[model samples]
Target: MNISLAQKARQNRIAALEYLRRTKQGAEAEGEVLNFFAHRAREKAKPVFFSVRARMDDERIAA
Candidate 1:
């Protein structure tokens, strides 16, 4: 692999870890960080299926 390509890959990894660290620090809402990663994963062509629901939502009972 070319040096330039390797450097770019390293930078990407470091940036990703930094973003995760910020999430751990609570710099942004937890949902925001999670959604950001989900969007990026899709852009990178990852196959991910997930279900999300708000914790405050009231449950419905079938009659």
Candidate 2:
């Protein structure tokens, strides 16, 4: 299925929020993020992964 750019962005934002929530609660988001990265890495590799992380970090800092 093809996802629109807006849909993908929404999904990424949801995932990032969940990650931030987990980390703030002293929960382990490392494995979840790593698993997500590993799966995406097979398709688009490192750059996408880093970009996602960067966006997430940026959002975190802004909040």
Candidate 3:
């Protein structure tokens, strides 16, 4: 399925917010600043990760 530019941007923003949550700053989740931070990371060459932890957790889940 094809997504619009705004929708894709929103997805990026959410991915960023999740990254911040899993990283050393999980306590501070503000809706406003997530997109800016995410874009900054993107500019530095980081892909948008939707659920990295979830993917890794499959090991335990399978067991």
The candidate scoring highest on TM-score is 2
Give the worst 10-residue stretch by lDDT in candidate 3.
Answer: 24-33
Per-residue lDDT tens digits of candidate 1, residues 24-57? 7784555454567767877786567544443223
Please state the error at residue 39 of candidate 1 in Å. Answer: 22
> Model 2, range 1-63, lDDT digits (tens) per residue?
999999999999999999878785663534334356766877684553467889899999999
TM-score of each: 0.37, 0.42, 0.37
**Candidate 1 backbone collisions, by pair:** none
Instruction: Please list the residue runs of candidate 2 whose C-alpha ends up more than 4 Å from where it truly belongs after superposition.
Output: 27-63
**Pairs of colliding residues, candidate 3:** none
Off by over 4 Å in 3: 25-63
RMSD values for the candidates in order, in angstroms, are 14.0, 22.7, 20.3
Question: Worst lDDT window (10 residues) for model 1?
Answer: 54-63
Point out the higher-scoring one by lDDT: 1 or 3: 3
- List pairs with backbone clashes in candidate 2: none
Question: Candidate 1 — what's its lDDT?
Answer: 0.68
